[model samples]
Target: MNKKEDSPSSLDLIWGVSEIAKMIGRTERQTYHMIQSGNLPMVKQVGERYVASRSKLIAFFIEDAA
Candidate 1:
């Protein structure tokens, strides 16, 4: 098997809007607004769900704290 097959999928690192909100302690609506307003990193939508990159979210918080 290849390393890619053994590793988790990219989707695994992608978080839903609600999950992102919980991580940042914000409301889902607020999170959506942030995304809409371009205040937050862009996400990839999968069906009805919005998926944000975990690394981007972490970097955003780290930068905010700086």
Candidate 2:
């Protein structure tokens, strides 16, 4: 397998909204609004894209569920 397959799917680093949205099953626009409206924590807009930590996204949901 390649490097990406060898490791986890970058779930612990900062990435743009498009990629982040794919991970969380949300549209890019929805993710943008989520960040803008402060619904999802630890997310922010940087230039034309919103950025967030994938691990934090996972943690937020897990925390919310509990």
Each prediction's Cα lDDT score? Answer: 0.78, 0.79
Residue 7, model 1: lDDT of 67
Flag clash pairs in model 2: none
In model 2, how large is the Cα lDDT of residue 1? 53
Error of 1 at 6 (Å): 5.4
Considering summed lDDT, which 10 consecutive residues are worst modelled in model 1? Answer: 5-14
In terms of TM-score, how similar is model 1 to the real structure? 0.69
TM-score of each: 0.69, 0.69
> Which residue segments of model 2 deviate by more than 4 Å?
1-11
Q: Candidate 1, 17: how far from true, in Å?
A: 1.2
- All candidates: CA RMSD in angstroms? 3.0, 4.0
lDDT of 1: 0.78
Clash count (model 2, backbone only) = 0
lDDT of 1 by residue, 28-59 (tens): 99988987888885576789888877777788
Over 1-66, each residue of candidate 2 has an lDDT whose tens digit, in order, gives 577745664436666887888978899899888887888878866797667778888889889889
